[model samples]
Target: MDRRTACLHQANAFREKALADPEHHDQWIDEAIKWLERAMEASCRAVITMEGDDGSDAPAPAFETMAPHRRVIVRQ
Candidate 1:
């Protein structure tokens, strides 16, 4: 599994444990939140590293160089 999926699985496990164990609720909840944040970061990284239609794994353009209306466009 990818980093994002792994992190999400970890988060879910933590959440389930938190719900089931009242004694360590705080610790499990905190861990779950941390894993969720990691998953989100991994997802963002995946999007940034996505290959172009030309099959080239080029880096995405800098946000500063893009116009407001074109910032979301991914050029090949």
Candidate 2:
């Protein structure tokens, strides 16, 4: 998976964890926030890398063809 997608996956995992238990919601949220920040950073990097200076012609990155994400069903 791409870095952004990986980060989002981590965030979702933590969110699922938080939903399953109420004892450490703050911790889970914090982790998710960190992952989200990383995801943003990764996205910025990808944009910069893909669209360098905008003067030269470049093909779209494979990241654009995003596939559907598999939903994780938590047995709550």
Candidate 3:
């Protein structure tokens, strides 16, 4: 699975645990948020790279394609 999908799976797992254990919800939420933030950062980097703004010495991709839920980066 892609980064976004993996992050979402992690978030859902945390959510399920949070619902069952209110005392540990804080930790679960923190973990979930971190996964989400990482996913968004990954997506942003992907977008910039796809757009040929990666600032790398290597050549740009001849064609670019984004994964699903790439909009999360913009929404963030």
Best by lDDT: 1
Worst 10 residues of 1 by lDDT: 63-72
TM-score each candidate.
0.62, 0.59, 0.57
lDDT of 3 by residue, 8-73 (tens): 788888888888899999998888888887777666544433444778887865544455554534
Local distance difference test scores for all models: 0.76, 0.71, 0.71
Which number leads on TM-score?
A: 1
The digit string of per-residue lDDT tens for model 2 on 16-71 reads: 88888789988998998999988877665522124356776777443432223433
In candidate 1, which residue pairs clash? none
- Root-mean-square deviation of Cα positions for candidate 1 versus the true structure, in angstroms: 6.9
C-alpha lDDT (0 to 100) for residue 26 of candidate 1: 98
- The local distance difference test score of model 1 is 0.76
lDDT of 3 at 39: 73
